[model samples]
Target: MIYSIFTALSWGKDLTHLFKRIEESKIALAIFSGKYAQSKWCLNELAKMKTLAEKNKLKVIPIFYKVKVDDVRHQKGEFGHNFWKLARTSSGEEIKQWKEALEFVSYKMGLTLCENRYST
Candidate 1:
């Protein structure tokens, strides 16, 4: 079963709680929006999910929402711009983990929903 942990739905949860949910779940839906790369928490969560998935403890599914897979994988376009901003203040190890996580998640089976698909 695919158990999704939407960040929007987890507004009040603590870090330990969030990590616990990810650890206990079978699948996690990581939605990569235009500004996703800008948030430190989101990137860390993705990194943690990547770590677990690598150990065969969890499965991560990426959702490219109004973003491109290649952009996310290679940190290109707006996503890259935001990531670079975060990278400047982040340690090399953090950037490495985040980048590896993004690259790993980008290659997994997932869905892409462009802006044209929905109106805001």
Candidate 2:
């Protein structure tokens, strides 16, 4: 099934509305995209979506744009291209938030959501 970006990123605006639409629709994946998603507020909102999906037993595929692959790194200072510099520049708070977000999404949703398909 096809889902519009408008509905995907409607967590804060109208998450229940969006979920109702998703439940009625046949879409296996939904893509959430927007510039506002880069903010901390959006991150918390996504955690909410994961909760909604779990409670409803729905599978959601989140699609993000403008987040370059080279922007993220693993704890071993690996993954991203500029690993050394990125690790050095990233503050403890930033890293903690990133890890916490990752853990929350993974534990709550039972899915990575990120495009880590190559890991398999």
Give one digit per residue, the lDDT tens place, for model 2 in 1-120: 343454555556655566565555433332223333244444444444455465765455534333322232132223233333343666676545544443444332222234554210
What would the TM-score be for candidate 1 when compared with the true structure? 0.88
Across 12-65, the per-residue lDDT of candidate 1 in tens digits comes to: 777677777778888988988889989888998999999999999998888999
Which runs of model 1 end up more than 4 angstroms from their true locations?
1-3, 6-9, 117-120
User: Which candidate has the top score in TM-score?
Assistant: 1
Query: Model 2 off-target regions past 4 Å?
Result: 1-16, 23-34, 38-45, 69-120
Which candidate leads in lDDT? 1
Go through the candidates in order and give each one's C-alpha lDDT.
0.87, 0.41
Q: Tell me, what's the RMSD of every candidate?
A: 3.2, 8.2
